[model samples]
Target: MNIKSVNKLHYLIALIAVFTSIEANAQEEIITVKKDSIIPKKEESKKSEEDRNVMLNAANNTGPREVNIGLPASVGGIMIQENGMPVVHAFWPELPTRTWRQSVSLAKPGLTKLSEVAITQGELGFAVSSETKLGSDTPSYVGNISSSSFGWIKGDVNASGKIAKNLYYTAGIYANYDPQSINFKFTNWADRTQIYRAGLTKKFENGKGKISILYKYSKSASITSHALFRYKLDGKVEEIDGFKIGRDNYMLPNGRFKYLDIKSGEYKWMDAGGRDNESFAHTVDIIGDYKLKNDWNLNYLVRGRYSESVSFNIFPTGMTQATPESGFTVKETGEVYTGSANSMILSYTPRTPLKTFMARAEIKKKTDKHQWRFGLTESLYSVDNFTNNRSFYYQAAEADPRQLVRQGAATGNTDADGFYNYNVGGEHHNGFDNKLAVFGSDTWEISDKFSLSYGLNLRWEKLKGDHYLTPRTPGFTLADGERTKFDHDWFHIGGSISGVYKITPSFGALADFQYTENNGLLTSYSGNVTPNLPKTRSPLMGLGLYYNHPNVSVVTQFSYLTRNNYLTRLNLVNPTNSSQNQVETVYYDIETTGITADIIAKPFKGFQLHYLITYQTPVYKNYNFNAFGNSYTYNNNSVEGISKVLMEIDPSYTYKDFKFWASFRYFSKQYANLTNVLFFAPRWETFGGVNYKINDHFDIGATVVNFLNQRGVRGSISGAELITDPAPYNDRLMVGTFIRPFTVEASINFRF
Candidate 1:
C-alpha cells in the first residue's frame, strides 16, 4: 500500500487501542452491592457469579498481546518508541549475543542504591576481515620504500553479561595477523606479524562502581633474499676470462660482453641475501569509577606500555655485480651491517572536568509559566611528551679512501648508534555554563500563529604548550640562532545566541549569531620576534527555515562568517655572520558566505533518503616575506568559490529470515577559485548486500562496495603560490587493474 494508506491504518489502530482501554477501565470499576439484610445463601452465590463474569469480560477487553519484533541482528536502523524512547528491534536468533542494558530503580529512602556496571550480554561470535594489495610497487621519495604485496587478517571473540542483578562483567580477545612478501626482480623477501588484545570489566552496586583491566601484545619477524649483478670492461670490449655466453645474454651488445660466457664463469656473484627483524609491544591498563549520589560521580584510570625491536642484516663480505644480460664482472662490495632500537611511552590523565576531578552542581525548578535549570562546572587537562630512538648500520668499505679514487666516493661509515629525540608538553583549562541560556519563547496559544525560542551560550578556555627538540651530535639550533625551546600561551572567550519561531506545527524559522575573541602570544626564539592580535575576532551569523514532519525534514540555511588577519615570523641566521639573521613572516585573513539545503526522508518502510546542496564563496587575503627583503601580498582575493550538490538513497527489504539492501551516492561537479579555471567532475558510488539466517545459531552474508567502478582524485596544496599540479590527486586514483566489483564475506555465530 501507499504511504498515505499505511499512515491512515496506523492511526486507526491507535484510536481503537485507546477506546478499548477506556472501555476496559470502566468495566473494571463496576462494583455490585447486595441488600445483605434480606439476602440468603443463594443470593450471595449469585453476586459472586456476577463478579466472576465481570472479571472475565474485563480480561477479554483489556488488550491484545503486543508481538514485539526484535530489532535486526545487524545493519538496520533502531526504532523509537512512544514518548520518544529508543527501543531495540532485532530478529530472533540473529540478534547480537552481547547486549548492554542500563536502568535506574527506585529504592527505600535514606538507603541509596549504588550499583554501577557495564555488562555485555551475548553468545560467542568470531569474525575475520582482511585486505590485500597486489603489484610491483615503486619507491617513494619521502621515506624508505617497500616494493611488495601485503595482506592482513583480524578477528575477535567477545562475551559479556550480568552475573547478578547489580553486578556485570564483559571480556573479549582480539587478534591480527599479516604475512607480506616483496619481489624486486629476482630478489624476494617476506615478513610475518601478529598482535593480540584481551580485556575484562566488572561492575557492582546498582551501577555506582566499576573496575576494568586490559592487556595487549604485538610481534613481527621478516626474512629477505637479495641479488646483485657485476660487470667488467676491457678497452672497448667486455668479456669474462673463463665463461661462455649463454642464452641468458639476450639483450647484450655484440662486442660489449661477447667474451664472457655463463657456463665456464665462476659463480662469484651469488644472491645478495636478506635479513630478519623482530619487534614486540605490550600494554596494560586499569580503571575504576564511583558514584556518590544522583548528581555526582568520580573515576580514576592508569595505563602502562612497553615496546622493543631488533634487526640484523646478513650478507657475505664480498659480492660482485654482473651486467643485466651478459655475465660480465664489475666490482666487489663489502659486508653489510645491522642495528636496532627500543622505545617507550608513558602517560596519565588525572581527575579533572573531562576526567575524575571535576564536579557539577545543578538546580532545577519549574513554575506554571516557565522552567529553568542552572549548572556550573570546572575542568582541567594535561598531556605528556612522546619519545622514540633509532639505530643505524655501516659497511667497512663505506669508510675506505680508495672509493675516493673512483668518480664517486662513499661517505664515511654511518653512525652505528644515531638517534633523535623530541618531546611535547601541554595543558588546558575550561569554564563555562553547562547549558544554553533561555529567556523567552513564543507559543501559538499565547501569541498569534508564530512561536519563537531564544537562548545563549558562553565559554572560556586557556591552552599552553612547551616543545623541545634535541638532535644527535652538534645539537640543532633554530634559524634565529636561538636554542631549541619554544613556548606559547593562548586564551579565548566565545558564545552564541540562537532563536527559532514556529509559523506552523510543521514549519519554523531560525536565526543564530556567534562571536569569539582570541588572544595569544606568538613567540619564535629562532626568529627573535613576537606579534599580537589584541583585536582578533571572529563572527558568524545564520538564518534558516525548517520544515519537520513525522518521517521527513527539510532545512534551508544561509550563513556568513568573517575573521581577522594574523601574522607570525620565523628566524634564520646568516651563514657568513652568526649575528646576522633573516626572518620570514606569513599573514592570513578570510571571509566566506554559504547557502545550504538539506533533506531527510523515509518515504518507504525500511528505507531512508538524504539530499544536500551547498553553495559558497570564500575570499582570502595573504602576505609573505623572506629575509632577502622579498615580499608579496594578495588583497581580498577570491581564493575559492564552489557549488556542490549531494544525493544519497538507501533502501532495504526484509523477507522470511532474510534481509537485503542497496545504496547509491552521487556528487555534482565542484568548482574551485574565483577564476573558475579549475573544477572537479561529478562522481557516483553504489553498494549492495544480502544476509540470510541459516539457523538459530548461524548466519552468513556478503556485501560489495564501490560497485560503480568510479574513481577520482582529491587533494590541496599551499605555499608561496597556488599549486595546480594534479599529482596530489593522482596518488588517489584507482588504476582499475583489479576486479571492478570486488568483495565477499561470510560468517557463522554460535550461542549456548
Candidate 2:
C-alpha cells in the first residue's frame, strides 16, 4: 500500500479504538453504580445530561421549530412539533410578518434531536441552536437607485432549558435586513429588521397548573421606494415617474403639477425617497392555567405590545422647471406663458410620528368533546403628522427670455448662506384613536361523524383628527382662514361559523361562514367636524373537501366573499371661491369568488412535493370617486393586488446523505389604473437548494434564488391614501420591485 493510504487506515483504526474504550467505560460505570447503590433515586442518570445535546443526524430533518405557522389570522389549527409536543397560543403575536413563520429555516438547528429522557421523561430539559447564512440576489429594475446584484448575511442563536424544578426558559436573537427579506441590498439599501425573544414557563406538580412569561423586542427601518419601469401608451413610451397616492400633488394656477428631476432637469412627478422611515415594537405575554372540576380546565392569557412608526423627510439636490404644455402664468394678466423650462427648488416634507399600544386577554377551556374561549382586546394610537411643501424657488438661466416662475431669485441655486424667503403651502394632520373588542368562541365534537365551531366578536373604535393648511407665500394660507378639522367614533361586529363531517378515517368535508371587519387608517389627530368613516366588511361562505393517506394529502375549498365600504377622500373646490377647500370621504363595495387547492404528496421514498393554487375574481360591485376635478366609474373592474390566478409549488428529494429542493412561484398580469389600461406583465420565479452531509459532524449546502433571473412586480395597486406611509406618496407596486434575479449562496453546518 502507498504511504498515504496506510496513514488513512491507521487514523480510522485509532478512532474506532477510542470510541470502543469510551463505550466500555460507560457500561462499567452504570454497573458499578447499581452495585454500590442502596436505593436508586427517581431522577435520570448524569449520563443523560452529558449526552443531552446530541448532534443532529439522519433521524430528524424538520429542524428545531417552536413557533407556529398559519396563525389565527390565516387558516387556524394546532401545530405538531418534531418532538411530538403541543404549544397552544392564544393569538398570533402582533409582529411584522406575524401571519406565519417566515419559511423553512435555512440553518435547521440540531435542537430537534433531544431524546425523550432529556425532555419528556424527565422534569429537566435543555436545548441550543445557532446558525449563520449569507445570500445574494440580482434585481432587474434599477430605475435610479442601487445595482443589479446584491448580497446579505443573517444569523440567529437560541437556547432553552430547565433552570430549576418545574421551570423552563428560552431566549433567542434573530438578525435580518430589509422588509420581506430573503435577501437585501449588497450595501446601499440601508434597511434592516432585528428581533429578540425571551420566554419562560413553569408547571405546578400539585395542582395541574402552569404559567408562562414571554417578552419580545423588534426594530425595523425600511426605505420605501420602488424601482421604476415603463408602459406603452398609444405607440409611445410613457415612463411613469410617480404614483398619485396620499401625498400632496400641488396644482399651479394654470392646472399643472410639477416634480423635480435631478438628472434631466425635467418637470414631472416621481416616486423618490424623501422620508427615512423607522418602526419598533415591544411585547410582553403572561399566561396562567389550571385544571378544575371533571373534564373542565381554566386558562387565562394577557398580552401587551407598544409600537411606533417614524417618518422624517429631507431634501435632495434637484431642479423643477416649467414646460410648454403646462405653462407658467403671468402674475398680473392671469394669462398663460408657454416657454422653455426654467426653475429650481429645494424643499422637504416630514410626517407625524405614529405611536400605538395594544392589550389582549383570553380565558379558555378544553375538554374531551368541547372547547370554549372568551377574549377581550383594547388599543390606543396617536400621531401628529405635520408637513410643509415649500422651497427656495429660483429662476434658471435657460428660460426663453421670460421667467417661468416670476417671483423667484435670479439665481439657479440656493444662496451661499442657504437663506431664501419663498415658501409653498403645506398640510397638517393630528389624529388619535381608541379601539376595544370582546370575542367568544366554542367548538363541539358532537359525534364521530361531525364537528362544529363558532365564534363572534364585537368592536368599538374612535378616530379624531385635526387637519389644516399652513401659511403660503402668495396663495391661500392658514392666515387666510384655510383650516379644517374632523372627529368621530364607530362600532362593528364580526364572527365565524364552521363545521365538518367525516365519512372515513381518510376523507372529510367542511363548510365555513366568516364575517370580517377592517378600516382605513384612522386620521383623527386634532380636528373639528370629523366625520366618522364607515367600517369595511367582508362576509364569506365556503365549502371544502379533504383526503388524507399515508402517501398523500389534499384539500380544496371554494368560497364567495362579499365586500363593503371602501374609504376614499377627495378634494372639493368651493363654488364661492372661498379660501378653504373641503375634503370628503367616499365609500365603495365589491364582490369576490375564489377556489383554493393544496396538495402534499410523498408518492415514493426520498421524494416529496407540496403544491398550492388559487383562482379568484374580485370584481367591483359598485364604485365612484373623483380625482383632479374628474369623476370615474370602476364597476365590475377587478380589484388591485388580486391576481386571477396565483400558484406555488415546492418539491424536495433525498438520497442517502444528500438532499435537494426547489420552489416555484407564479403571478398573473394585472392593471395599475382604474381605467384598466395600464398593465404589468406576468412573472414567475424559481428557487432551489442542495445539501450534502460529509459525516455525522459536518454538512455543506448551497442555494440558488430566482434561478431563472426573472423580474417583475408580484402585486400592484392603483393608488390610495397611505396613512401609515411616512410621506403622502402613491402610484406603486405591492411587493417585489421587479422580483430578485438569479444568485447563489453557499453555507456550512457544524454540529456538536
Candidate 3:
C-alpha cells in the first residue's frame, strides 16, 4: 500500500475506537446539581469547621479554599484547600486532563453515585523560549571540515478541556528553528533547519478507570552547503580488475608527479538526519478495584498497545571537491600526465520500518496497613522492508612529456565513464524481540515508627534477526557471486530484588540487586562469515542510606557491577609480510563501581537547595587480543582505568515577589584511554535566572546559561598504533575549541 493509504488506515482505527468509547459512556446516567444549602450535622459540620481553621493558619493562603499557586497563572495556576486536597488547572501539551471538579456536595439524590463528571473545566496556554551566545570562537573542523557557532529558538501552544461530562480533549503545536555557520579557515559554510510538530489526545474517565488516545505528526527540512576534500592527479587512470580502478603507477616513487597536493571544492549535502522517522500507536487499558464483603480490596489491571514506524534515508554522489595547485604551483613550465577515473567512491543509504505490540495484566490485594501486587507482561517486535545501500568510485591520470621542456601545459584532465560505473550494494536487517515478565511488591508497617517494603521482578527475553545484502550495481558481483544472508537468535534472563527499611522517624536504608545473562552471534556479510560471541553475564548491586528532617534530607548510595566476556576487534601484523589484519575475539571480566550522594534542603523561607555528587571507577580484566591468524595476550592486572568525579548544585530563592535560581556542575579530569598525555580535561559550567511579578496578569523573567565558557578535551590513541608499538602512540584529542560562554534570554508572560 502507499504511504497515504497506511496513514488513513491508522487514523480510521483510532477514530473508531474513540467513538465507540464515547457512545458506551453516554449510556450511563448524567446528573446535574445546583448550589444550595443542604447541610449535614455532626461529622460534616466538624469537617467544614476544621478545614476553615487550617486555611486560616496557612501563611500564604490567598484563596477562599486552601491551595498553593506555585505555577505561573497563565499555565493554569495551582490551588490547594485547607483540607489537603489538590486542584490542578494546567493544559500540558503532552499530558492533558479533561475534568475540572470545581466543588463537591454531600447531598445524595436517588440511584448509586459511583462517579461524577464535570464539563466546565479546561485550559489553554502558549509559551516561547530563545537563546543566544555571549562569546565567539573560530569554528573547528571535523574530518577536515569546519563547523560554525550554534543556537536555537522554539515555541509551543497547547489547549485542553472537557468536551462532555466524561470525555476530554487536548491538542498542541510546536516549532523550532536553528541556523549555523562554520568557518574552515580555508573554507566557510552555513546551514539552516526548521521543525514542526502537532499532536492530539482524548481521554475518558469514570471513577478510578481511564482510557486515552493520542496522535502526533512532525516534519523537518534543512539546507546545507557541500563539504569534502578532493585531489586531481596528473596521470592516466586504468580500469583495473573487476571494475576496480587504480593508478597505473599509483605507488611508484614520485608516481606521475606532484606530492602533497591540496585543494578546495564545493558540493551539496542533504539528509533528514534520521529525524524523519514517523510512527503511530494505539493503547487500550482497564484498571479498577472491587471491595469484597471481607473488607479486602482487590485491584485488577490489563493493558495492550501496538505501534509502527516508517523511516528512510538517501545519499547520492556527483558531489565533488576541487583540487588545489600541484607541487605548490600548477607548473606551467612542464608537461604533466594524469590518471583514469575507474576507482570507486563509497556512499551509503538506509531505510527501514518497525512494528511492536505489547500486553500486560496485573492483580493486587490491599489492606489499610499493607499491599501486595503481581503482574505479567509480554511484548512482540518486528521489522519489515529494511534496506541499506553503498556505492564506490574509481579513476587514473598521466602527464604530457613534451610540455615539460618549456612553460607549463594545461594539467591533464580526468573524466569518468559514467556515474553508473560506480558499484552499489544494499543490505536489509529484520529483527524482533519477545519478552515475558512477572513482578510483585509489598509494603507493610511493622510498627508505628518503623515500616518496611520490598519488591521482586523477573523477566525473560528472546531476540532474533534476519540479515541480507543485495547488489544494485549492474555487472558487479561479490566474490561468492551471490547475495549474503545471515540469521541468529538469542535469549536473556534477568531478575531484581529491592527493599527499603525505616530505621527511625527521620532515617532509612535501601538495597537492590540485579543480574542478567545473554548469548548472541556476530555475523558479517563479507564472504558469508558468521561468528558466535561468547555468552555474557552481568550482575549489579546497590545500597543506600537516607536521612530526613523537617528542613533537610540526604541520600547516599554505592553501586557496583560486573560483566562477563565480550567480543571486540583487534589488529595484528601479518606473520609473513607484516601487514595489518583485523579479527574479533572475546575478552572476559569487566567491572565498575560508583558512589553517589544527593541532598535537599529548605532551611529558610522561600529558599531551596539541591546537590548531587558521584565518583566512579571502571576496570577491565583478562585482556586478550585476536587478529586474523594471530593471537596476543596482556597482563590483566596491568590495565588501570581512570577515575571520574561529577557534581551539581542547584539553589533557588524567593523574596518580596521576586525569585532567583542558579545551578552549577563540575567534572574532574578523567583518564580516557591507555595514554599518558591524553587525559580527559576537567570542565565547569553554571547558569542562573531571575523572575519578577509586575502584577496578577503579567510577569517577566530572564535566564543565562553556560556562564563560565569552559572547554574540555577528550583524547584517545589509534588502535593501529597500539597494536604495533603499544606505546609512543600519538594521542587523538578532540579539544573544545569555541563555546557560547553564555546566553541570556528574556520573556514576558501573560495570564487571564
Candidate topping TM-score: 2
lDDT of 2 by residue, 1-752 (tens): 11111111211111111000010000000000000101111111222211111121110111121110100001111121111111111111111222112211212222211111111211011122212111112111100011122344445445555677777766656555422222222223334556676677788888588777777676654333222333333211122334221111211211212322212223333122212344466766666668776645665545555555432222211123344444344443545554322232333222234455555555567778777766666667666453333333322222112223332323332232222333332234566667777777677878987877666777777767666533333332334444466556676666666666787876777676656565544332212224334566656566777777778767777766565664433323222221123344455666767676766688899888867677766676567766346565778877544457767687888899998888776656655434455445566666687889898756778767667755444233212211122121223212112344455656565443
Query: Which ranges in model 3 have alpha carbons more than 4 Å from their true place?
Result: 1-151, 180-208, 219-349, 385-428, 448-452, 468-493, 517-535, 565-589, 627-643, 674-677, 692-701, 714-741, 745-752
Model 3, 1-752: lDDT tens digits are: 11111111211111111000011001011111111111211001122210111111011001121111111011111211111111111111100111111111111211100000000000000101011000112211111111112333434334444555555544444443333222212111111222221222223243444444333333333222111112112111122232211101111111121111001111212133333322233433333344544544443334333333322222211211123322111233322323221122222222233444555455566677776655565556555533322222212212111111111214222122112222223333455556566666566656664444444445565656655343333323333234334444444444444455667756666665555555542112211134344556656566777777768766777766665554332222233331122223344465556677766688898888867676665445676655455555543322221335767687888898798887776656543333222333465556677879898766777766555644222212122213333222232111111222345555555433
lDDT of each: 0.29, 0.41, 0.33
- The deviation in Å at residue 240 for candidate 2 is 14
Residue 220 in model 2: lDDT: 53
Number of the candidate with higher TM-score, 1 or 2: 2
Tell me each candidate's TM-score.
0.45, 0.60, 0.54
- In terms of lDDT, the poorest run of 10 residues in model 1 is 111-120
TM-score pick, better of 1 and 3: 3
On the 0 to 100 scale, the lDDT of residue 200 in model 2 is 74
- Which candidate would rank higher by lDDT, 2 or 3? 2
